[model samples]
Target: MESFSGPDATTSDDGPPPPSPRARSAEARRDAILTAAATAFVEHGYGATSVDDIAERLGVSKPTLYYHVGGKQELLGASFTLALDAYSDAVEDEAVSGVTGRERLHQVVQKYVEITTTVHGRCLHRVPDVELTPEVRDRLRAVKRKVDARIRDLLREGVRDGSLRSADIRMSTFAISGAMNSIAQWYAPSGKLSPEEIAERLWDSFAEGLRPR
Candidate 1:
């Protein structure tokens, strides 16, 4: 019978071990900081929120917060990007479902509204500003343009299928996007109408003129 010399006897040399529990805990702390920063930014707006405020919200030291994020601007950028990603995912998911062009368009719009009224939505609109560095501004603009292009593509499809009327797709896209994106301003789940109701009303008003009559 062969005897094993040790655990290493059967193991080939490989890279270092996985991240330790401490490292994982650190990562979790970083995520907590980002989440806290996002909530603070949304509740108070970018101009009013400070790194110290975020750190306090997370109950962490300023140095610990800095260890995770470089500074307030980086935190803002991360928050905005997170929100944009959610919005884009909602639109893309609805768009991919096989449905009538009109139905798909309305579904996409509804999803947009739903996402924009959430915490993420509030951060996206309130974080960007003149104070952002050029890099952050460019990143924000690029994300916005991507979302716009997606809306324009859907609207063009609706027009081609005759489910929507002829209109300036560009302006129409902008209008619809702007309307839904503004939900962070006044929308509350406790408000007079539910998110679904708001979406229906918006679709009814906008599609009324566009629907084939």
Candidate 2:
């Protein structure tokens, strides 16, 4: 038997075909729905923002919104997942950069500041944990724990390498993370300080505190 190729098919040299117009259209609409959902949740809190509110914000009928992205619960979950994944990935990536632990921690701080200040990042803290199902909340908690462990590990590495001061790692971790996480609470896009500036300013304070005597 011989294999036959259709007119639309390509040889092995060609990369995978691009997404079909319909698939692209559907993806764009789904993104729009997610954006509207995130904005509503951030602005009004999850409990007060219903699926109907998201649908109205998107200017799409409830059925259309459901067809694209399911209900309010799913949208909220997706938004949280997006924000958390970004934060986790940023930390893990910096952890493996073959640099001093203090340097890597510096990088992680900046990334955290920039990501948490975004619209999606705000979703991570804006919506209360009670709004999520037990399963979702548990899974998110695990991710956060993993990130926290990585930060602690980096602190240890800094101590061993003599790049950071000898101190209570747990208290230091708490102080560093607690302060950085609070940025989402008061961050304003139009604020005088840019994320980079804010990151630098915060890092300066942290670096001084962690410096070797």
Candidate 3:
């Protein structure tokens, strides 16, 4: 009986097996494509950006780009999804670790502002202009609804705990969301304030009523 286990099975305790060549290649291609798309989209709005531009940036053919992403619209949608997922993850993480309702809310907002100042933020802003298919539109709307619900939950907690003044939950949720969403429009990495600073400012303004208190 021939020994089936050879040096291949011998444990030298080097480390984990390296990724397959194909897997590494695929990952590299995917990252390159996404990076190129991000740059092109930032330089040229979604409407002006084409799949060919992405392909050119990646030094790959149009078909290669299509193999990774369906088309410009799908790419745009994917970009937006990536950005929202990052922001949502940050908020979810902070909420889970926060000690109090007010602290949770503050952390969520701060993380969100930080995300909006990233390259992902530019992709998020372009989402509105992308002509998403019905399914994509529904998915995007569902994401928005989830985020809105999270904001509402935070507000409700604050009101219940007497930290936040009572107000119309629905209206307050919308107001808070709108304020955070606008960060993408004006936030810049080189701007005067960091995300943390901005978040503190926003918290102070929202919590203290911006009056002479």
Candidate 4:
């Protein structure tokens, strides 16, 4: 028996090769498109922004943009999702740490401050829920509920440890969240304060007020 052999053919035992550069390139392109969408939504209000606007910013066609993230709706959803996921990660990490409740609150608020200055973070803070589709809005509501519960638990622990004065958990949640949410409103890159400085200042204000007498 003879095995067929061509002049340029050799039998090799190597399996499939690693992912091609093209695959990596596509991933990068998708990320770029998403970033551009975030920027557009920030510059112009989300209601005023369109898929064509995003595509224009990227120098890409509407269909090309769609190929990456489906459409404007999904792009907006992804931005909010990214912001919330970072916040969730920060909260989860600090929740189990042995630090006192006051310190834990500082870390959580600082994370929010850092995220609030970014484009996606700003979008999440500034955009109203009415701007989102029914589905994404509902999903975001559920995520927010979970995050709020963690905050309330942290506040209760702080009060128990006598590190913080007595306060309503629900009220504290609104106050802390409102302060963080307002960052995107007044913060600017050219401002005198850096994000760290701003975060420190904001946390100090809350901490001073909460300190036990």
Candidate 5:
């Protein structure tokens, strides 16, 4: 089976000092803040959710919050980053290390589904141009476009191997993406379905239609 390494562990640590006890605490706090912020962003519109709202959610003072992410825009941007990282972690995985295009793409869909259902995924999808600074908006768009490209590339690879049907790559992407993104709108954690089950079901449904006729 193929294995993928994340950016942090993918490299050997250089000469940097081990994080101090304070640094570790700070890191943990930052993660907590980001998680809280992402949840707030998903629950409330990015424009409507204030820094104070996130601080309140985490039960931290504004100064403590600022120490982690600085402000709302940064928090919003970081939430998007969290989503992107999830994508890379999933799509980049070895996926039983399949060599065929369809095999690999199925794994991508599965992982993407699993990732999207989480807090990070919703944050990734929910951010909007109206709420973000122009620069941040553009940055998030770039990240999203890159994700789209990754999907297209996998599809094209599949087609080349005769494992996938030939289709309009761009429209195909929109169709698949629209279906996947809708998961966030209606999914419930309390529902009987688990993330793995949902991802597998989605892959089964999508794979049948996506194959060459």
Candidate 6:
């Protein structure tokens, strides 16, 4: 088993600080705000959704919404960032550590699918990038590229370990990622297939092609 280290998004001084009870509570509220904002954006389109709309949906004053997650643009950026971080973290999960390359890749695909079928995940892919400022769009792209690179690394490792057949890494990465991203556009919770079931089926399809010949 090999360990993969990518870019670190956070910086620490001396070490990481522990969260206070108030800070933890604040973070939870912020998460709820982001979720509401994403849900609004998905239902009304990012361009059509306003900070006021998000506030109304959450039954909070504009000031409280601003305090928790800032304005509309800030909320949108934060929502997309949260989704991307989830993708990056999926690959870094401790449970996948010490597993075969193919197994690690499988877990990653499963988690990616699970996240894609979520509210925040839908916003990440469905929201128009034109709604974001150029700077915010670039930042999100960088995070996404980092994630794609990590997936390619897993593919390389799998081939080296003889668990998967050799193939075009970049194309395969795009195919796998594109499929996962598209799920956010069409997946319905009320549909026959649950998120877990979708993940299992998608992984099985990818796995057959990836398995060693």
Among these predictions, the greatest TM-score belongs to 2
lDDT of each: 0.74, 0.82, 0.71, 0.80, 0.77, 0.83
Model 5 Cα lDDT, one tens digit per residue, 1-213: 112334433334566455555657777788898999988988887878888898888887998877777788888777777777677566554542588778887877887888888887877776665666677677767766766787888889889998998568888888777888888876766889988998888888778888788
Deviation in Å, model 3, residue 174 alpha carbon: 1.6
Candidate 2 residues lying further than 4 Å off, grouped into runs, are: 1-15, 93-98
- TM-score for each of the candidates: 0.77, 0.88, 0.78, 0.84, 0.82, 0.83
Number of backbone clashes in candidate 3 = 0
lDDT for each residue of candidate 2 in 23-107, tens digit (9 for 90 to 100) = 6777888878888898898888888999989888878899987787678888888788888888778877634575688988888
Q: Write the per-residue lDDT of candidate 3 for residues 71-190, one digit (tens) a residue.
A: 887677677777767766765644455655666777777877777777766667654643666765676677778778877787777777766763587887777778877877777668
Q: How close is candidate 1 to the true structure, as a TM-score?
A: 0.77
**Residue 20, candidate 1: alpha-carbon lDDT:** 52
Q: In model 1, what lDDT does residue 50 have? A: 88
CA shift at 120, candidate 3, in angstroms?
2.5
* Candidate 4 segments whose C-alpha is farther than 4 A from its true place: 1-20, 93-98
Q: Is candidate 1 or candidate 6 better by lDDT?
A: 6
Candidate 4 local lDDT, 8-107, one digit each (tens): 3444478544444565678778889878888887778888999988888889899898777787778988888888787677778534465678878777
**Candidate topping lDDT:** 6
- For every candidate in turn, the CA RMSD to the true structure comes to 7.3, 4.8, 6.0, 7.4, 6.6, 7.9
Write candidate 1's Cα lDDT for 1-213 as tens digits: 112244344444585545555666777776777788878877787889888898888777888877777698888777666776776677665445645567778888887777777666777775556766777677768777877887787778878887787468888887887887777788765799988888899889878866876
Off by over 4 Å in 1: 1-27, 93-95, 189-197
**Error of model 1, residue 127, in angstroms:** 3.1
lDDT-better candidate, 1 vs 4: 4
TM for candidate 3 is: 0.78
- The alpha-carbon deviation from the true structure for residue 159 of candidate 5, after best TM-score superposition, in angstroms, is 1.9
Residue 11 lDDT in model 4?
42
Estimate the lDDT of model 5. 0.77
Model 4 Cα shift for residue 54 (angstroms): 1.4
